[model samples]
Target: MYVLIPAYEPDMRMIALIESLKETNPQPGIIIVDDGSGACYEELFQTASRMGCIVLTHETNRGKGCALKTGFSYLKGIGASGEVVCADSDGQHLPKDIMRVGSCVEPDSRSMVLGGRRFSGKVPLRSRFGNSATRFVYARSTGVKIHDTQTGLRGYSTDMLDFLLEVPGERFEYEMNVLLTAAKYGYAIKEITIDTVYLNNNESSHFRPIADSASVYLPFLKFSGSSLISGAVDFVLVLLLHSLSSSLILAVWGVRCISALLNYTLNRNVVFFKESGIRHRTAFPRYALLAVLIACLNYLLLFLLYKKAGIPLPLAKILTEIPLFLLSYWSQKSFIFTLLNPNG
Candidate 1:
């Protein structure tokens, strides 16, 4: 196994961690990526190199995701055929915990093992709140219940390197993207409890909570935003067409044709577009078929609610959309844009 550390503006604590890893029973090769910490940190990198780590440097500062990909690419080029365990250089992850995560890596099993922290102690307020909010949103979006969505200590087998390199994100958001993609591709994620250490309330972390959180949550936000805008356009067009034609069928068809085109474009180009190999030729026909099905169902429900159930037309339209909204999201996600063969 190889130990990979992505360091930026690190301190002497990194040297101590390196020394501890050097003394392990079966010492693992250490690869540390200097994420453009600059010339001032050259001495620290030299010290780590003297301590027997293969230190790689970036000319300028790149994000943690880039640093990790650099390390993975180097490892792949060298044809390393074992597990690679990634740990932070801020002294939060213990050397022993890093080894523990590495020990859990099974050669044949493709599962990614994460060193999960319980957050039991006096955690920083931001750390606690961020983890809680991200966990809830992650579960709601992907139906995967991960305890720590932001854990930096993770173990990956050699086979996973290619896929990891393909996942999109540049900074803190990269880790979240990995988890989301893993869940989507049906990769089994196993979490092992590890020590939770926060020095100075995790002040060493360079994560900009607002900006990075927005990047991490952008996928879900984009999906919801697309839906909301499409819904608004549909509503306005429905009312306008109804007023002009005085026919529910004409209004529903007109609104759906306009809104469906808008929603499909946004979803295909922005929302579910990352690394999703689905071509427009394959996805558009399925999407058009789903649109027709949903349109018919929506109009039937609207007619029943408005004409037979004694409800106002506007209220009926609103009520009719709730179920179809969920159905549309599910069908588009599962049938229209899904990988034809996820395992392949």
Candidate 2:
């Protein structure tokens, strides 16, 4: 096994972490990628080297992704072909959890082991909500049912290293990008709960809420945009049908029904795009149920807006269905085209 730590301006706590790992029953190769924490922290690197661990140095401060890439290159350079466990410099990860994840790694390890954080018992409200939202987005985008999407402590087999290295984000978002890419490449990612230790309640976190969220959510937002196009199609069809036949309220519903089916089909094939091979069996029925739910809610809201609010029927149909559009996106992501199919 190989242990990789990406450190940036780490303190004495990190030395303690290294010492703990060194004392493990069956020790593993340790590689520290110093992301240009420079002369001040060279003593730790020197100590790590003296302890028979490889210390790979970066001249400048590169983001976490670059540090990880550097670590993979170092692993390849040393001819080490085993599982690599990446833990943070901040000492939030416990050594036992690393070993637990390591135990799951086989000779030809092909899966990624994520150290899932069980954030229970009065975890900070903002932290809990933030993680929950990101987890949902990641699960929807990648079809990986992970509880913690941003956990830095993870184990990836040697074969999976190249995939992680090629991922595109520079910082924390790189983790999310890798998750999506792993799903794209058909890699199996399993999550196991690990002890939670918040060194500073995330005081050292480098996350910029808005900017990082934009990076993380860019794909989902694009998916939502696609759903919007579908919504527009459904809306236009409902309006057109209402105009052609005044008595055919059922006809308007039928047009929306057809349009929703088209929207769901395209979104399933192109937007969420998971290959469950369930099109013939579960896909249509599940989608039909979702469409019916969305249509009923949309109609009720449109009726209320048009009759009670005294708005034009066509205009009300457009206005009231906006919320329903968002609802359908979430519904479809969570239920409709998800990887819950047994085959997937």
Candidate 3:
């Protein structure tokens, strides 16, 4: 196994962690990325190098995601194939836990093993709340429940190097993107419980709560916003056209046609925006097909809810959308804009 550590403006604790890892039985190859810690931290990195860690340096501070990619790229270039485990340099992860995560990386099983931390002890307020909120949003957005979406200690086979390099996000969001992409592509994520260690309320962490949190949550929020805008347009068009024409079918078709066009555009351009290498020729037809199916379902449900169910027209419209909203989101993510090779 190769251990990848991304360090920025780190202290002696980083060197200590390196030495401890060296002491492990069957020590793994260590790669420490110097994310522009500058000359002041040169001596510490030198010590890590002397301790048999291949230290890669960056002239300027790249974010954690960039640093990790640098390490992965280095490993790939060297043709090193085995388990690659990523651990934080802040000493929050125990050496034993790192080894445990490394051990969990199975060559045959194409899955990422995460060292899941349960924030049990006196955890930082921001750490606890940020993790909780991220967990909830991640689960709802991907329909995959990952308890520790923010954990840095994760292990995966070298075969995932190319995929990880392709995943977007330059900072904290990159990790979240990895998990989201994994869920979308059907990559199994196995979590191994590890000891939770918070040093000085995790003050050593360089994560910007507001900025990083926004990056992490931006995808889901954009998806929700696009859906809301489309739904609003659909609702308004349905009511206005229905009131004027007194034809439910006409109203539903007209509203959905317009709304689906707008939703597809927004989703393609903004929400799940990426250079997917999938053209509109391929995606549009699938999306349109889904839209038609959804429109038919919407009309049927609305008709039943408003007519037979005795629900108010407005209430029925809202009720009809509740379930379809989830269905639309998942469909777009899973089938429409999904990666061609999710397992990678």
Candidate 4:
């Protein structure tokens, strides 16, 4: 196994972390991709080298994502291949936690293992909310109930490293993007809960609250935006069809069918462009089945609320719309979109 750490003028805690890693049994090969921490840190790299660690420098700061790519490529180039674990330089992650991640890595299986952080104890307020919000949105968009998507404490098989070359984003957002892309490729992702310790409350962290959060949450926003457009289209078409036909039920089904097709088309082609390989022929039938399932559920709820319960029609519509929209989004992102292109 190989351990890769991307450091940028790392503090003394990094040295302690490296030392701890060296003391572990079945000593793993370690690689530190220094993102241009200049002459001041030359001695630190040299010390690590004397301890038989591979020290690769980036001359200039290229961001964490770039440093990771360099390290993975280097690891592959040298034939020291197997599973690779990525740890943060800030020393928030424990070296022993690698064992938890290691236990989940199957020799022949292609999966990404992530260390789930337990936020039950003394965690900062912002950190807690940020992680929780992101997790909820991510679960809705990807259908993967991962506890922590932002943790750098993760393990990936060498074969999965191929994605390193294709992954975009240069900073914090890169890791989040990789998880999404990995899911798109049919890779199994599992989460293992571990201790959460903020070495310095991440005060010196490079992550920006609003700006970086936007990058990390981009996919969720895109999904929400797409759903909004599709919902509007669905409602408008339904109203138009109702006006065209005397039978309100006929208009409802017709509008739903048309809007579903439109939503699927836009989501597959635009939102998740690289993963739209469900063979147009096979996709429609499966999508139609899913659409019908949603319609039935929607109709049942609408009827129960508006007629039986005697709620105003508009209020009942709004009540039913919320749950319906959520169910449809999750089903589409996880099952429909995923099946459409199983081998992306």
The model with the greatest lDDT is 3
Q: Compared with the true structure, what per-residue lDDT tens digits does model 2 show for residues 76-195?
A: 766778788999877888999998887777656556888999897656555677788888877655456888887888888886665666667777678877776666556688889998
Candidate 2 — what's its lDDT?
Answer: 0.76
Task: Specify the highest-TM-score model's number.
Answer: 3
Clashing pairs in 3: none
The lDDT of each candidate is 0.87, 0.76, 0.88, 0.77
In candidate 2, how many Å is residue 179 off?
1.4
Task: Decide which is better by TM-score, 2 or 3.
Answer: 3
lDDT of 3 by residue, 196-265 (tens): 9988878889987778999777766888899889989988999999999999989988898899889989
- Summarize candidate 4's per-residue lDDT along 1-344 as a digit string, tens digits: 88888998887887888888888844788888999989998888888777778999998998888899999889778866678888888778888897668657776577888998988778877778778877887776666778887888888888776666567678877887787766756788988887788866777567665677786566556667877887788778778887888778888777777767777777777765544456666666667887788778878998999989999999998898787777776666556655533334
List model 1 lDDT by residue over 1-344, tens digit each: 89999999999989988888888744799999999999999999999998789999999998999999999999999988888999999889998899999999988575899999999979998888888878976776666799999899999998888888877877888988889778877778999999999998899998776677887677668878999999899989999999999999899878888998999999988887864578888999999999889878987998899989999998897798776766776567656876756544
C-alpha RMSD values across all candidates: 3.4, 7.3, 2.4, 3.5
Model 3 scores a TM of 0.91
Candidate 3, poorest ten consecutive residues by summed lDDT: 335-344
Candidate 1 TM-score, true structure as reference: 0.87
Candidate 2 regions exceeding 4 Å error are: 226-344
The pairs that clash in candidate 4 are 278-340
My TM-score estimates for the predictions, one after another, are 0.87, 0.68, 0.91, 0.80
